[model samples]
Target chain A: MPVTNRQIRLARRPVGPVRQEDWTLTEEPVTGPADGWFLGRTRYLSLDPAMRGWLDDRPSYLPPVGLGEVMRAGSILEVVESAHPDFRVGEFVSGSFGVQEYALSDGRGTRRIDPAAAPLPTHLGALGTPGMTAYFGLLEVGALNEGETVAVSGAAGAVGSLVGQIAKLKGCRVIGIAGGPAKCAWLTEELGFDAAVDYQTEDVRKALRTHAPDGIDVYFDNVGGTVLDAALTRLAVHARVVICGAISQYNNEHTVQGPANYLSLLVRRARMQGFVVFDYVTRYPEAAREIAGWIADGRLSTREHLVKGGVDAFPETFQMLFRGANTGKLILDLT
Target chain B: MPVTNRQIRLARRPVGPVRQEDWTLTEEPVTGPADGWFLGRTRYLSLDPAMRGWLDDRPSYLPPVGLGEVMRAGSILEVVESAHPDFRVGEFVSGSFGVQEYALSDGRGTRRIDPAAAPLPTHLGALGTPGMTAYFGLLEVGALNEGETVAVSGAAGAVGSLVGQIAKLKGCRVIGIAGGPAKCAWLTEELGFDAAVDYQTEDVRKALRTHAPDGIDVYFDNVGGTVLDAALTRLAVHARVVICGAISQYNNEHTVQGPANYLSLLVRRARMQGFVVFDYVTRYPEAAREIAGWIADGRLSTREHLVKGGVDAFPETFQMLFRGANTGKLILDLT
Candidate 1:
């Protein structure tokens, strides 16, 4: 019997803000696994700002999603049919299976995720690529030490939420920068950030002054541009600014926004570094274990803003992340 | 008997370059030493660009050279008379003895500069502030590992010249950046620099690309702005950029030209830090010993661009440094 499922394919490349016309929904006939392949039914599709970067035809750490190809995405799936010895029927797995209802994988770079360990969506979030990005970026790259102050932009979002939490777990005084009162409340009140800066209402520089009076030691930057400029002014001696994402600049039609006032690095004797999560693929299990422990100990909490939708709703759901419409990790559940 | 002689005093504050109009030479009625004081006759005075910074009414690492103050300069003197317990008459002494014919000291912070062991100006150049700045800036801050590529701008100047020779002494592949071809040639041919880029004629970034094809491991920055930006582009993985000074930015009438492209730090996971040599004052003797030893042996050489003029010529002497007219250590010998 032929296996078939609905898939979201890239219809056209986007210019600025990605629209529904950019994506095309279609049904694809999935071939049965030949030998070491397993059939995957897409359960939860992760909506990340990095998806916008994949739409543009540029040389990034990852290749752009080609036109007429299935739009790339990280998904958690239940194995329905298995010809692979590693993956069995009824086992849950996670992989870059694209925005689809069903997928067939050769099991290379795919992990069998546990549902009982945490919610299936949490595996796509706190235990997923976002968690690893935060872990390695903060500990390895930022070299965050105990008693240091950590100030993270996009503090209410997926990766940044975890970054602030993990920094706090490392005994750092964590400050969160987000859009609205709700996100700030979620960060400081729920996620355990020491301080929260509402980028809309409060001046970031003034907020940083009020919170980190001694200046920030580690800055986990997610939303770049103006927010980055504000953060640069408040860096202490030997501070580290980690460039995780620039969601604000991703949609700009003119130019990719780079920081203007980086001379502060020279004056403050500090450093700024950028990283991609894929660089730490070999160390993911070690990172995931620590994040899981934080969650279990009530030190780190996983917040998933689940948006129920079919594969056709991928374009609109992904827009929610850009508009700051979704809090925590935005996940699309295809039932 | 009165220890009376001529002295130069700061007449007015300079707006841009320290001109001849900024100084006034007059006869000062000097007095003999009291109970704990020693009277010394000035022999050789060290003229430095740091004098220019002192003339400005700003809080730098040290206090500004004040109006009506005997224009501050480091001097080597012969003790004509002594009442201080530790210092004896006819002994050689070194201290911040202003631009004057005679100075009285309490021997609190004065050290004996050996004229028999080496030339008196060597105490100001290779064994002075420039030498100390270069030694600590490269080893402790630049973290100069063996066999690493080191790129230093202003390589013919006091600090830069010493940095290249020391990096070479430490088994590093050193590149010197200077203003003229003659200076550049001297750097590679005599000073033992691996390569030299004349910034006046050569494209700094392109030259760096050709010379340091393996990419620069450590950048000892003295001239900031464009040279720093050029070095920033050529950084290898885990590079360290040491910001010693920005001679280009110091005299800027308008906005100090900063580096436009600094995002490369993110790609390479590099670090750039600025430091003042004064902070490392306690370690000065330690650096002095190592650098003095390097000069004592054939491992290092000293160069002095000496101007034969009275104390009244101090302001014009300082202006030459900003114009890049002098090579090696710029000093004025007071007769």
Candidate 2:
């Protein structure tokens, strides 16, 4: 008897906001794994803003997902069968498993996970790429100092949330910029951020003037566009602007809106730097250990917005990230 | 006998390109030097792109040149009368002496220069602020390394020309982006630039691809507009962009056009940093000594476009920078 597999594949590249017509759901018969390979059942899929960049055919850090191929994604999966030496049946692992019910892996980037250590979704949120992004983006790239003021955009998102918390732990005053009142409140009250600015309602430049009167020492930017321009206007002398991501401009049909106040770098003698997390892959274990300790000590928290309905729900659930509907990590529960 | 001082004073702030109407020529009786002051005759005035930034009533590294005030300028002057202990009569000095035939100085920012070492205008050109800007901007801020590829915009101008020469002296492959055939020819033929892109006729991005091949290790941006955008796209891994000046956008009546392809910084893991030459004033002697030695040994060369007529010609001569009319170190020979 053969098993059936359901998968969402890229149909066409999206122009602005991704639509359902951009993807095609297909059913195929699952094949057994070959030697040095393993078969896994997808349990959860991580939907990130960076996924949007991969959909464009333009040159980037990684290649674009080809049409008719399974949409690339990070996921937590359970090993159902294996012919490989390391992976065993009934063991859970994390890797780029794509948007499918079942996947075959050669164990290239796969890592075994202890499900009892933390929630399965936690492996995708805090202890995953988002966590690593925050750790390196703030501490290493930002070079955050004690008592210095830090401002982070997309403060309620997975990476930004962790960034603010980590800044707090390092004795820095952290200010967060988010889209709504609820998210702003969560950042200030729940995450221990010093202050939160509601970018949806308030003037960001004025808010920054009020919150960080001395100007931002380190600006960890996830959202770009107008908010980025505003932050540029309030940089302190020798400030560091960490360009981790620019989710705000990811879906623009035209070109990205360049920061108009970029000349502020001259007046302020500041630096704007960009980095990719995968470049620091060799040190992931050390970063992950530190993050896990913080999580265990109750010094850090993780939030996951789980949407159920398998791989077919992927297109709709992925839109939530751009719409700011999800407060934290947006994930699809395929279990 | 009293000296009649003819001065060019700021009459109004400029909206776009500066006009004769923006300045007022006035003659005043110059009094004897005070107890700690010295009286000096202006010899040559440096016409810089940064002067345009001073005319705007906005926040910057320095205050705006106030209306009715003598226009600030870096000039080579000869002391005629002195009451100060440090400065002596007939000594040539370099300082911010304003656009005037005679200037009264307390010697706060003034430094004595030996006219026998090089030409008088060389002190206001290659051994002055422009020289210091190139030295620090490339070596320290850009962090340029040997055998690297370097691209510099406004490559025929004072700072840009020196920037390319310094990069060449460091054993780097230097490419210069300048306007017109004459400036481009001079950059490669006389200045030893490996390649010269005539931005007026050539496609800068394609030219960069042909010249650099791999990518530019350092992009020293002096003209920030379409040229800056082109350079941003060709950055190598860990590239440094030194924002020294923006001559192209300095005269715009509206907002500056930001670099549309700034996201390349992220894709290439690059950085853009801005700095002021005044910040490195304490180390100017060290940099000047190195530059002077390079000039003495024929490793580095400098060109000065000296315009005749006294202080009254400042308004028209300054316009040459915006028009890209001068090749290197535009100066008003007010001798």
TM-score of each: 0.84, 0.99
lDDT tens readout by residue for model 2, B1-335:
46699999999998998989999999999888999999999888999999999999999999999999999999988999999999999998999989989988999988899887789999888899999999999999999899999999999999999999999999999999999999999999999999999999999999999999999999999999999999998999999999998888888899888887888888899999999989999999999899899989988898999999988888998999989999899999977
Alpha carbon deviation, residue B174, candidate 1 (Å): 2.6
Model 2: clashing residue pairs?
A: none
Worst 10 residues of 2 chain A by lDDT: A110-119
Question: What's the DockQ of model 2?
Answer: 0.84
Q: Write down the lDDT of every candidate, Cα atoms only.
A: 0.85, 0.93
DockQ of 1: 0.28
Off by over 4 Å in 1: A1-28, A47-73, A97-104, A223-226, A245-269, A273-280, A308-326, B1-81, B89-111, B253-258
Candidate No. with top lDDT: 2
Residue A155 error, candidate 1, Å: 2.7
lDDT of 2 by residue, A1-335 (tens): 29999999999999998999999999999999999999999998999999999999988899999999999999998999999999999999999989999999989998788887689999998889999999998988898899999999999998999999999999999999999999999998899999999999999999999999999999999988999999999999999999988889999999888887889889999999999998988888898899899999999988998999889999999999998999888899987
lDDT (tens digit, per residue) of candidate 1 on A176-257: 9999999999988888899999999999989899999999999988888889889988989888888787888788776655
